[model samples]
Target: MTEKPAKLLPPNPTIGVFDSGFGGLTVLRDLLPLIPGARYIYLGDTARLPYGSKSRETIARYAVSSAKFLEEQGADLLCIACNTASALALEDIKQAMPIPVVGVIQPGAEAALATSEASPSTPKSVLVLATTATTQSHAYAQSLNALGLAATEKACPLLVPLVEEGWIDHHVTAEVLRIYLNEAFAEAPNAQTLLLGCTHYPLLQPLIERTLAELNHPMTIIDSAAATAADVAAYFPPNPNGAPATSRFYATDSIEKFQRLGSAFLNQPVSEVHLLDLGG
Candidate 1:
């Protein structure tokens, strides 16, 4: 009998994407097209959300718990989709976990750099709209420095709750965003590049774009989820033929709430969500 050629075995685990809350679903939505055949498990700590307001120590603790849960779920790769956790506890999580870790911060930064490089005027300044914690973390600023661009970050504190409540098109939503945008622009008037640093912000993209258009400013808006999704795509197996991709959603609190609010983020009906208690 002739010896058989060695067969290539597929990876036996799923990719875990963790975020403070449903905001990370936006990242998942963007990543779906990039990795069509990969399996994914997403966990949203809705009970302990607004990680932006918590201390770094608390955020790290939450991150640890989240990572542990994913590990138990047979995750071979991890993606920290929350900028707050990525900024505060990425190193600790990476060190504690056995699998390779990826984050949204660097990918967003790289996109900002590429956007700047492509523009003729060289982008005198760029605006980063993120959570209060992300702005304080200075993750975007450091990334922009590595690429030689002056970046300014604005903390849009009210936007998260607005997004979580599914108020993307509410009249008050526009007013709230306008106030933050005005404040951020005041701080960095020359900023010609704008970065939607938080995943939830993308849901408000149309409003944001309209606001920018009304201002009559020629600025480029960067969607961080899209950029991070591209990064996630680069890590898949080289072969095109593989198992079809599948996604699972988990929440620390109400699965009903997650399914309802998640429709806005995922742009589809979220029929299944498992409740997980992340006791810290």
Candidate 2:
């Protein structure tokens, strides 16, 4: 009698992704294709956005609540897609959660390090553009230095609000970006790489690129959200071999607005967004 070969079942677990607002959708945009078979539960806490200015205690509380909600929703793994939250709340969230929680900062730091390798000399000065919280935390700079790279970080607190308002091409946005970029250049003139330390900043990439061009500076701008997605792909377990193909979107407020703004970030229809009361 011949023995039958075992069949492989798809991974039933869903990956939970969180952000303070729509910014994290950019992370999801880059993530989905890489893990096409895995199910994703994306939650955007639009109700309490702009976590950048919030106190550490508040941000940590919100992060823990968000993670608990996701876990209740059957998340096997979690990714904190918000740079501000990742900067301020990652440690507390990790401690509060039973499952693995990844943050955007470390993955982005890894990507920037990889890019810096192109010019190994001078210890590779790098610039990080991020929210006030991220800049204040010095997460990118510390991570880069830990990896033996000289890093400069600047706070672009206004960038995310502008991006969320769908003002990427606005002249004001360009001017604001120029001001922040100038600060970065002044701090580290030899910087050959610019890390878009916040997910929302990628929406302004073209303008940022143009501003850099005008300065006659040709530095690589790393999109941290995209890099985070790459790291998530690498983190997924291979034993499952396959996973569910569906993705679900949830928001703490205005599912309609999320869908509308999400198109710009995800470059796809977010017609399936479901509203969440979150029982505040």
Candidate 3:
């Protein structure tokens, strides 16, 4: 495994990104444009996914292993793109790994704070849309509150399946999101920022904006994938003339499904996903 360099990053650092499944590709998608001349190693632990259902200890073990695997592949930085893993096992992974590990919660909260400050007229409140486990974890609330921004976490349990099923613009999906947003808005009318707590939500950003306009409530939308990418981007200076990024994707299981769905998540073709077996 590569050791953390004394400095933050090299000229063209290798970055590791991991999620339980295909959703993490969204983070990688955002990263390519932000940090040019970089290498990305993405892992979809498809064989043992839905880390939300596992115990905290188990989640930590799995996430740490994934981080180590990426490190072994020459990653200097790691992004735990999964909300459940970020909520449940971030510290464990950070402690075990030799590199910097940035999770979605802090970046989202900080971005909300920055955006809220930019708009003095709006309330310093954030509405987070995430999975039930993430909402119950209250990780976003704690992070936001620490920065003097109030947070309301709404668990959109149906959104993940809807997203995975490629229903980004379907009417039923829109209705479900509309209901969730309305319910969340009812809870926090003052929320000025909508934080996407789930990486899968970036694909639904267009539809989310439409729904907000339909409800006559237009809040600044924050994609954590973008936020996390920006956070990682801070490690290096802008280099417009840098070389194009190269990527390698590995899936623990279902390479075909990962390649199929990963294309949509990445908004680009995904080919030659290597199969990796991390023992259970």
Candidate 4:
């Protein structure tokens, strides 16, 4: 008797990724290759960016609006890839959206914990480098501490601007990172893992590693963008022979700037970016 062929699921699921600005493209970049069959929609609320300065209530409102927009666009799942929004507004977005929502903070902390557990004999501590808002929220610290790992969070407010300026390997950027890492290490001298809590930081991974070596603190660096992508991937089944992934970009502000700067973050050409207005 001939055996029945294996059942096949839909070739693609519409995934929506939202951020307060262009940084989150790093997460989408990782997701693209991993989940090759998915249709991705990326929204950068650039008009109201620097969400770091906004209050929790304001951030929540903006995040919810973005989430709803994605839902309207038929997103089957959503990824809140902004650290500030993830820290302050994840719950609101989750409740507002009908689709499943994932945030960056939790997966990052979990990845740190798993990395620590991998070496059972040594004491493990995590150092999180993030935006001021995320550090102030203490989301990463709380999550890691809950998993029984000591955690320290450092707010690198300058890194975002530097990355956005396309200065990933500039000497000035390196010096800035050195200063930040110096202070961070001073606070968490024993930290064996360094978690890049900002989505933009992935573009500076090599520079970070070099800085850590210079500081005499060679630690395992965890890219939260990659970690969050890995977590999101768990929700979808394998799509080995599925169609090539496609993406749509939307920005609440200048589409030209989004296309130009976003290309750096996504590590690929961003050809068409639609302008959106999420309102004040």
The candidate that achieves the highest TM-score relative to the unseen native structure = 3
- Over the stretch 1-280, how does candidate 2's per-residue lDDT look in tens digits? 0111133223444789999888898898897777757888999998887677678999989889989999998887798998878887888998999877889998888887887776566348788888777888998888888888788888887887788788999999988888888877888898888889988888888898899999898888899888888776665544345553567998988888899998888888888888886654
Q: So what's the TM-score on candidate 3?
A: 0.96
Q: Which ten residues in a row have the lowest lDDT in candidate 2?
A: 1-10
lDDT (10s digit) by residue, model 4, range 1-280: 0112133224588999999889899999999988878999999999997898888999999999999999999898899999999899988998888777889998898888888888886567889999888999999988888889998999999998898888999999999999998898788888889999999999999999998888788899999999999888777778898788999999999888999998888889999999888789
- Model 4 clash count equals 0
- Cα lDDT for residue 259, model 2? 90
Provide the clashing-pair count of each candidate structure: 0, 0, 0, 0
For residues 145-256, could you state the per-residue lDDT of candidate 1 as single tens digits?
A: 7777788899898888888877888889999888888888788988888888998999999989888887776578888888877776665544456566689999999789
The residue-level lDDT of candidate 1 at 133 comes to: 87
User: What lDDT, from 0 to 1, does candidate 3 have?
Assistant: 0.90
Give every collision pair in model 3.
none
Off by over 4 Å in 3: 1-6
TM-score for each candidate, following the candidate numbering: 0.91, 0.90, 0.96, 0.95
Task: Give the poorly placed runs of model 4, Cα more than 4 Å off.
Answer: 1-11
3 or 4: which has the higher TM-score? 3
